[model samples]
Target: MDPKVITYYFADDGRIPNHPSLPLILYPGALKEKSDRIESIFNENNWRNSWTNGVFDYHHYHSNAHEVLGVQSGSATLQAGGEQGTALSVQAGDVIVLPAGTGHKRLNASPDFKVVGAYPNGMNYNLRRGEIGERPQALEEIGKVPLPETDPVYGTEGPLIELWKHKERD
Candidate 1:
């Protein structure tokens, strides 16, 4: 099925300089009851280093890698971008693609809320909570991240590939 895609952009928030070539991409009800399928899709597209869990309850971002989170069960309200970011309501089968340096947090969640998360190229990630001291290193690392060769859910072509490539040209 062609999933509904939504995108969000954030400016440099002093602490977290959200990516210029990437935006937060959300695919609602993309996984549905098939949330377990996320691993296979992510793996096939080179998004390795998988984990199953819920999002953090506090604001944070990763500078070392881009991340993809597939909602396996339950629902939650998530804050993305930064302090001035937008809040999103997510449920089972939903998927969120976070570019390196994009901040995110779990504002609230259902008891059964769970997610499958992974990174492109099996990248190891470091968490930063918008600390002023973390800005320099985070910015450097974020700038070094390469665009993924494939979309986490849509293989080599999809909204992610199309949008990110277009952003690069702008």
Candidate 2:
């Protein structure tokens, strides 16, 4: 069955410098079985350099590449976009794809909460804390960051490719 997808667009909130066009993608219960092999699945789709860990309590974002995080176990409430963004509750088997420059932070999680994260094309990632004097560069890099050729969860054609239409940025 095709996975159900939910999309969210975050504005440039000054501090976070969220992506202007791409909406964050969510796939609830997308990896119901074999959640333990999320990293392998991601790598298979060309989203590489996988890592397993818990989300940071403090808000942070990547400016160099898009990110995909799959819930390996347990559950958590993750704050997305920025301080003004929404609080999303995710659980095991859920997948979240964040475009470059989107802010995210962990509000709370279960004791065993763990997630597997990967980047498109094994792109090198850079961490940003929505600090002062970071918006200009972050925005620039975000615009130049290319879209992934395949969805981390679905491969060549999926909700990601359909929803993330490339747009020209100023």
Candidate 3:
């Protein structure tokens, strides 16, 4: 199925300096009743190094690699793009793709809210809480992150590849 991609451009918000090339992608209900199918898809698409857990409650971003979060069990309200960002209500079978430097936090969740997260090429990730001192290095790292060869949910021809590559050209 196709995903509904959402793009967010955040300025140097004095805290989190989000990415320029990639946008946040939301594939709502893309895995409905098939939450367990995510691991295999991610692995097959080269999005390896998977883990299952709940999202963090406090706002944070990854500076090393992009992340894909598949909602495996329950529902939650997630705040993306830092403290002043938008709030999103996500449920089971939904997937959220966050580019490097995009801030995210779990505002609240149902008791069973579980997610499977993975990185492309099994890339190791770094945690940054938008501290003032971390901005310079984080921004540099964000710019250096390579684009994923394939979309986590959809394959090579998905919106992620098209949009992200388009953004790079512009």
> What's the lDDT for candidate 3?
0.86
Report the poorest 10 consecutive residues by lDDT, candidate 2. Answer: 161-170
How close is every model to the real structure, measured as TM-score?
Answer: 0.94, 0.96, 0.94
lDDT for 124 in candidate 1 is 93
Ranking by TM-score: 2, 1, 3
What lDDT does the true structure give each of the candidates?
Answer: 0.88, 0.92, 0.86
- Write model 1 residue lDDT over 58-98, tens digit each, in one string: 88999889999999889999999888889999998999999
- Deviating ranges (above 4 Å) for candidate 3: none
In candidate 2, what are the lDDT values of residues 40-72, reduced to their tens digit?
999999999889999999889999999999999
lDDT of 3 by residue, 1-170 (tens): 55676666665567877676577888888888789888888888889999999999998999889999999998999999887888999999998899999999999999999999999999999999999898889988988889899988887877788878767611
What is the lDDT, from 0 to 100, of the residue 106 in candidate 2? 99
Best by TM-score: 2
Model 2 residue pairs with clashes = none
